[model samples]
Each structure stands twice: as structure tokens, then as C-alpha cells.
Target: MTNVELKEKIIEYSKEIGIDKIGFASADPFLTLKDRLLEQQRLQYQSGFEEKDIDKRVTPKKLLPEAKTIIAIALAYPSKMKNEPKNKKGERRGRFCRASWGEDYHRVLQNRLEKLEDYIMSLVPEAACKSMVDTGELSDRAVAERAGIGWSGKNCAIITPEFGSYVYLGEMITTLSLPPDTPITDQCGTCNKCVEACPTDALVQGGQLNSNKCIAYLTQTKDFLPKQYRKQIGNRLYGCDTCQQVCPENKGRDIHSNEEFEPDPDIVKPLLIPILQLSNREFRENYGPLAGSWRGKKPIQRNAIIALGNYKEESAIEVLEDLLLHDPRPIIRGSAAWALGQINTERSALSLYRAKETEKDSDIVKEINEALDYITSEVRYAK
Candidate 1:
């Protein structure tokens, strides 16, 4: 079969295998993306999760010497949960973003890419392929944009007309010389909803993102969340979708094409109190399969404490006090102290006072002192 005929076959096979969108592009160097990445690095905007080598990231040839074409594929994930659990006064919940709603997208996309690779190898024995999902060196969004899968939106998401900005992207580089498709035109004319809606102003400008301040990046971090961003993150336990949530193009766009992307209400919007008390095995067993759990239970538990603080769920004071006085991880202890301050109950003051006397970590000590000060000031003012 000719390269064109093979391409057609691949497209047909993609649909059969449940790939939502597919586009082909020549294996040319991403020069523009290289410049932007350098700028992002210079400004210290990187999230530290990206590949460190700039050359390896921008040049496809470096990844595969015989590279001649790239096949970019997008899988649409569900934006809204069907039977999402409710958050009440004492039974507050924290959320994992839409991307982490179901099974990890990396596994789902890789499975499709492997199937595609097997099909192509059968057609052309000489074909060589390298497939990458989100964690790979090459940027998935850049590959998708070049391959005409979608236009890169101001929110830093590849916005497909059919799926809006709610799609998971992955790509494969191959030695076969296939015809490339035309890229989509930028349709975000005069629309600034995403930029404005950013809780941390992570989208400094259209098509540019400062990942350090991004709530999505912030939520995944293992360290104690900075004071200013604690309120901004609200109840988000894993990722942030404010920018995409507010976009004009994404309005009313919710796809449920893939069953794997469907969310379990109890897992995605889990109760905050039980998460605080989850043992390692219990955490892994309950959340290990979801994408949000990749960073482990600490960050999620920390965010859960902060969510309780954000909600001022007074009912959580007892558990927060126990965590402040006893949790081994300083991040949990410190965040628990902060949450106690937010709750401002009479018992919370005594917990902070006792924690302050014994806390060895300077950071945790500082948080405890701040909590005590907040409580003291509130009491004095109320009198």
C-alpha cells in the first residue's frame, strides 16, 4: 500500500479503536516552540515536571533519527461528573480536576498508540516508531497543534472544535513519509475569559503560561503551599481547570465518549475528613488508579486540610487538631495548624499552643505561631 493509503487505513483503524481525533504532521523541528520554552525557562516559569533538555524537547530528529512523520492523537475526557457527590457542612469534600477524574490518561493513550504502532508495522515492515504520552520528552500539545488536531488556546490547552479544551493529547513519531495536514486557525478572537479567570494569573498572556503560579501546578507540589495561593487553590486536590472552565469555546462542551474517562463520584470528590486519616495502603488502594494520585497521598491530604480551612468546616476541627499535634509530615502538621486558625474554635487555640511548644521544624513552628496570633486577634476584636 502507498503511504497515502496506509495513512487512510490508520485513520480508519483509529476510529475503530476509539481514538477521538487524529492528525498527521511532517517531522520538522518545532523552532517556535523552542524559543517559547527558552523564554519560559529564563523567566523561571517551568513546573519542574517537564523534560530538562530543551534540544531534546524541541527537535523530533533527536528522539528518532529516521523520523519523517508524526501522528498526533487526542482522546476526549469527561468534563462534568454524572453523579457527583455533594459537599455539606460537616462532610466537606475536595476535588480532583477533570483530567484526573477517571483512569490515568497516559495509560489509555499509550494503549492506543501501541495498537497504532502494531498496525503500521504490519503494513510496512521497515517502519520505525516512537510513541509518547504526556510524560515524554516531546511536548504533546505542540505535536497536536502542528498536526492540526486542535488550535492551542490562550489557556495553554489544545482546543478542538468538537471537544473544546477538554481533550488528552498523545503522539507517535514514525519513519514513514506521510502527507501532513493543515493546522487550525486561532479562533480565540478578543476572548479573554481564560486569562481573566486564572486564579493565580498563570496565563500571563494569550498562549503563554507561568507554571509556577498556576494552580494546576501548585496543587501537585509536595511542599507547603505558599500563603497567598492557599485561598486561590480552594478545594482543588490535584489540578486546576479555572481557565478552561471559563473559556467561551468550552462553554457547554462536555464529552463522555470514553468509558475509561468516567469518574467515580466517591473517589474524585472524596470526603475531606476520611482522607486526613487514610493509611498508606488505604490511600493507594482507593486512589492509586486515578491520575491525580500520582503524587501520592501527602499533597492530596494537605490540600484536603486546606479545603477544610477554605470552607471553615468547624466540624473538622477535631481531626485537624489531631493532625496538628501528631502527624509526622510537617506539611500536614503545618496545614492542619493553618486550618485550625481558619476554624478559630476554642479548642483550636489550645491545639496550636501545644503544637507550638513541641514543634521542632521552624516552618511548622512559624505556622503555629501565626495561627495563635490569628486566634488571639480574633478573640480580642470580638470582645
Candidate 2:
């Protein structure tokens, strides 16, 4: 069959296998993907890698020597959820981000793309296939925009009129030169809400995101959190969704999905008490499939503690007390101690003072002492 026929077959099978939208782009490759990645890295914005990798991703044939066209797919996720039930008080907003609320999307898209490849190779038998979803340098958003799937919103996400920006992107690069879809025009005219709403000022002028200032990046990233950003983090434990949450264009598109994208009811507004007591294994089991995997449990637990501290949930002092002495990771323990100090409870204050008395590690002991001082201003205990 011809490449056009292959494109048709791909669209048919991709939709059949549960992808919401499938569009074709001649692997013109990521013109901006390479440059933006390089800019991010040069500005020290990347998770890893240097300018060289970014260069390759931006250049078409350089990225995939045999790549001809790319098949990009978008999966919509639920944009809204029921607020916490009144009985379950002290609930924090989601840290999992809107896109990662359900099953691992990487796994979901891989299964479908592999099937599409199998069907194509059934006819060609010699075509090469490499599927990627946020793994490599190829820009899924750029390809999606070029493929007529959607236009890139000022929030730096591709938004389909039908689904808004609450969609996940994945692509299959192959040796077939499929007929590319028409590109969409930019619709973010005179709109700056996404930029304005960003607490960290991650979104620069236009749709460009200054990664260093991006709360979503700093939250899970290995980089040290800027002093100003901690307060803005609020209760977000995983990824930040502030921009999309306030987008005017995203008012009420395909608001939710029946797919595995549905969040665990408990996850929508987590119980902070148990979260403070979570072990490494427990943390991994609960949020492993979600976006929290990258940071492990330290960040989530730390954020949970901060949320408790912010709410001044003195009742959670018991839960925080347990974590201070029992939690394995020093970061979690330190953050928990800091939280207990914020709760203004005598029990938290005494537990912290006792933990500080015996704690020898300078980093941890210092934090515990600081917390002790903050919680009990009148009690001047010698270190």
C-alpha cells in the first residue's frame, strides 16, 4: 500500500485502539524542538543532556536517519473532579497534574502505537518504527500543531478545539512518507492569562516557558528550589496545573474521559495525615504510575508536610510526630519537623525537642532545632 494508504490505516487503527485523535506529519522534524531544548539546557533548564542532543532533535533527518513521517496521537484526560467531600477536611489540591491523574499514559500510548506499527509492518514488513511520548527530543506539541491536531496555546500546550489543552501527546516515527495534515493557526490572540496566573512566572512573554521559574519543573526536578517558589508551591506535590486551570479558551471542551484517565477518588484531595506517615514502598505503590515517580516519595511527603504546616492543622501533630522519628529519608523527616513547628501544638513541640536532643547529624539536627525554636519560643533548650 502507498504511504497515504498507510496513513489512512494508521488513523483507523489508532482510533480503534482508543486514541482520541490521530494526525500525520511528514517528519519535517522539530525545528523548534531542538532549539528550545538547547535553550533550556544552555540556560540550565534540562533534566540532563547538553546542547548536542538538542541540536539533533531539531533537525529532521538528523533525529531519525530513516524517519519519513510521524504519526502523532493525543489522549484527553478529565479536566475537572468533584471537590473534596466536606467530611474529609484538610484536603490539598492535586500534585499529580491534570494529565497524569490516572494510569501511566506512557504505557497506554505505547501499547496502541505498537499495534499501529504491527499493522503497518504487516503490509510493508520492512518499515522501521520508534515510538516516543515525552521521552526524546522530538517535540510532540510542535508535530501535533503541524499535523492539524491542534494549535499551541499560550500555555505551551497544544489545544484542540474539541479537547482543549487537557490532552496527552505521543508519536510514532516511521519510514513511510504519509500525507501530512494541514497546520492550525495560532488562536491565542491578546490572551495572557496563562502567563499571568503562573505563580512562578514560568511562562515568559508569549507561550515560551522559562523552565527555571516554572513551578512544575522545580517541584520534581533535581534543582534546588528558589526561595521565592516554596510559598507559591502551596499544596502541589507533583506537577503544577495553574496555567491550564485558568485558560479562558479551555472553559468546557471535552471535559472528561471514560478511559483509565480517571483519578482515584482518594487522590483528588489526599488525606494528609496518612501521607505524612507513608513509607518509601507505600509512596511508590500509591503514586508510582503518576507523575510523582521522578521525585520519589521525598518531594511528595515533603509537600504533604508543608500542606499540613500551611493549614496549621494542629490535629495532624500526632501524624507529624510519627514521621519525625520514624521516616527513613532525612528530607521527609526534616520537612515533617518543620511542619510540626508550624502546627503550634505542645505535643509536636515536645516531640521535636526530644528528637533534636538526640539527633547528631548537623543538617537534620539544625532543622529540628530550628523547628523546636519556632514551635516553642519560650523554652530555650541547650543544643
Best by lDDT: 1
Tens-digit per-residue lDDT, 1-383, candidate 2: 67677678778777778888988888765666666666666666554422346555665567568988888888888876665334234544335677667788778777777888888899788888888877666677877888889998889899897888888898878888788898889888998899888897778776677776777776675432443576687777677888988887788754565467777867745776777666678878887877556667667767777777767777777777777777666776777777777776778788888778666667778778877777667454423
lDDT on C-alpha atoms for all candidate structures:
0.93, 0.74
How displaced is residue 296 in candidate 2, in Å?
Answer: 2.6
TM-score of structure candidate 2: 0.87
Least accurate stretch of 10 residues (summed lDDT) in model 2? 85-94
The segments of candidate 2 whose C-alpha lies over 4 angstroms from its true place after superposition are 49-52, 82-84, 87-95, 222-227, 369-383
RMSD of each: 0.9, 3.7
Clashes of each: 0, 0
Model 1 Cα lDDT, one tens digit per residue, 207-289: 99999999999999999999999999899999998998898888899899999999999999999999999999999999998
- Compute the lDDT for candidate 1: 0.93
Candidate 1 lDDT score at position 336: 96
